[model samples]
Target: MLELQCAVRRDMLGLADGDSSAYVVPDSLPPRARLGIYRNTATGALLTALRLSYPAIRSLVGPEFFVGAARRFIEHCPPPSAWLDAYGATFPDFLARMPESASLAYLPDAARFEWAVNVVLHAPDAKPLDLGRLAELEPAELGHIRFAPHPAVQLIQSAFPVDAIWRAVLTRDDSALAAINLAEGPVWLCVRRTTSAVAIDRLAEGQWHFTAALLAGCPLHAALDQATDAAAHVWLATLLASGYFTEANLEGQVSNLPSGDPAT
Candidate 1:
């Protein structure tokens, strides 16, 4: 049964030619023709999943071009799991490598940004850090603290203004899209789910580095060292207030921080 399933999957994904002998055919329809129906349906569903996850990419490239590119991607890289929402995580990298997308240098980054939003939208929920407990720690203990970022938090760095491009494209603001300066340096963005909606906010380079280090499990002092600017503490405070982290640890011990007002 497992072998048959594997064979069917390979056939559906275009990884192998259909073996009509393996399928029970209707009297009127050829086995290969019946199999093609299933294959086409599966392909269409996968394409829809990609379109849902990458609406900006679709808008940027138009329906025809996006479909062509997406079909090629689906043929080469089928989803790894049953969860379609988790599919296409590597699509941004795929776009970067596609020869047809070479003219749109920011296309990959825009796809990446959209993927991050998709990830956060589907991420598991968790309680935000307790500000009251964090405030109780001694000043000396601050340097030894490490934080666990919320499950929905995602940090992205892009060479082009992908956020701006994503916004313009999705909103269909042609003037905003046209005014985008591709050479506008790099952008660091934080994509997180709020209580009611998803948010995409830009971060300063220093803040980006500091938050990245913390997300990587660095202790407070170590993360501060990675900050390129003098406002490391300010950045940390702002992030904490925004509910970026769920827990904080001091040294090797998990701090028993009670759930308090995150805004505090």
Candidate 2:
């Protein structure tokens, strides 16, 4: 039974030629024809999943082009699990390698931005941080505080103006799309789910680094050290207010800061 299932899946994904002998079918319905129906249905479902996850890509390339690209991607990388939400995670990399997409230099980044948005939207919910807890900590203890990043948060850095491209394409704002300057330097983005919807915000390089460090479970002082900009404290306050973290913990016994501590 396991072998039969594997054979059916391979056939459906076009990974192998149809093996009619593997299945029992009525005389009126050829076994190969029955397999074709299953294959088509499976392909359509996968295509729908990709379209939903990458609407910006579809809009940017048009339906026909998007279909061809998605089909090729599906053929190369079939879904690894039954959960479709996690599918297409590597599609951005695939697009980056596709010869046809080579002309659209920013397409891969745009797809990556979209995937981040998709991931945030589908991530498990996390409790918002209780801001009142911060006031209880002594000043000396602040440096040892470790913030737990919200599960729904995702960070992306792109050389292209992917944020602008995604916004314009998804919203169908032709003028905004045309106004985009591809050479407008790189962008660091924070993608997370808010109370209402997914929010995508561009952050300065310093803030991006600081937030990334915090998200990686670094202590506040350590993360602050990475914030080259003078506004590190301000950025921390803003992130706290935005519910970027779920909890904060002092790394060790709260005591006087060590002489080597960045805070000192």
Candidate 3:
């Protein structure tokens, strides 16, 4: 009987949406009263997590809309894990399909940008390559080198100038009125937590290409060759100064590259 009661409560809390009539243990009011409590608790926890994940989206749509959308979201896609961070992975897509809110074309992209920011904040940081280590590598040796960026580094490209939209919303003042053509080209964004704070920077076309190439594991020389501007070293220096790349693995059988430790 206790096992049966546990199952009923689990269903009530949405752990499993089973047949209500079949499972209704019509014994006493107190018997299933606890089940209702569990259900409310489960729903409340999910609502809070969703609100935290998409505060900007909440602000954009207002509280009533956010809660309504969240209820629908919980019903369709119950979180598969207890980890709150992993709970809202489907939220951006959910926003895209919200019937009443579908008019806001930019909403999905803005939510996606916010998700990227959240991802970056949790990623690990690392030290960038030093100049001396880079100088020691032979021309042929540049090909096999590998690099690892700080775990927090993320590249977000969106049709909307989402970074601008995000900034406007965050600043709470729409005073800086820059006309953004929603259909205009996508903005390539670099999101990372550097020395000061979590930052979002808009990448120029050339810089975007350069970063993309590097991210794709291209060797330094090849990445530079493919870059439009061709001033690869300058770009590399700029990024290094900005504390982007943390680990530089040189090519060839050499056990180690020169320590570019900014600490030294």
Root mean square deviation (Cα) for candidate 3? 4.4
Per-residue accuracy of model 1 over 1-264 as CA lDDT, tens digit each: 778888888888888887533755466877788888899999999999999999999999999999999999998899888899999999999999999999998899999999999999999988888877877888998888888889899999999999999889989999999999999899999999999999989988888888899987799898887678798888788988999888888878865453556544
> lDDT by residue for model 2 over 88-130, one digit each (tens)?
9999999999999999999998999999999999989877677
> Which segments of model 1 are wrong by more than 4 Å?
19-26, 135-139, 253-264
The true-versus-predicted C-alpha distance at residue 246 of model 1, in Å, is 1.0
RMSD of each: 2.9, 5.6, 4.4
Q: Deviation in angstroms for 119 in model 3?
A: 1.2
Model 3 weakest 10-residue run by lDDT: 253-262
lDDT of each: 0.88, 0.87, 0.75
What tens-digit string does per-residue lDDT give for candidate 3 at 1-264?
A: 777676765575466655343555556554346456667888899999988888888877899999999999998888876787767878899989988887998999899999888877666655555656766768787666766565778888888888877777777755632555577778989998877788888988788878877766566767877888767678777876776666667655343553355444
Q: How big is the positional error of residue 129 in model 1, measured in Å on the Cα after superposition?
A: 1.3
* Alpha-carbon TM-score of each model against the true structure: 0.91, 0.89, 0.79
Model 3 misplaced stretches (Cα beyond 4 Å): 1-15, 18-32, 129-132, 177-185, 250-264
Error of 1 at 180 (Å): 1.1
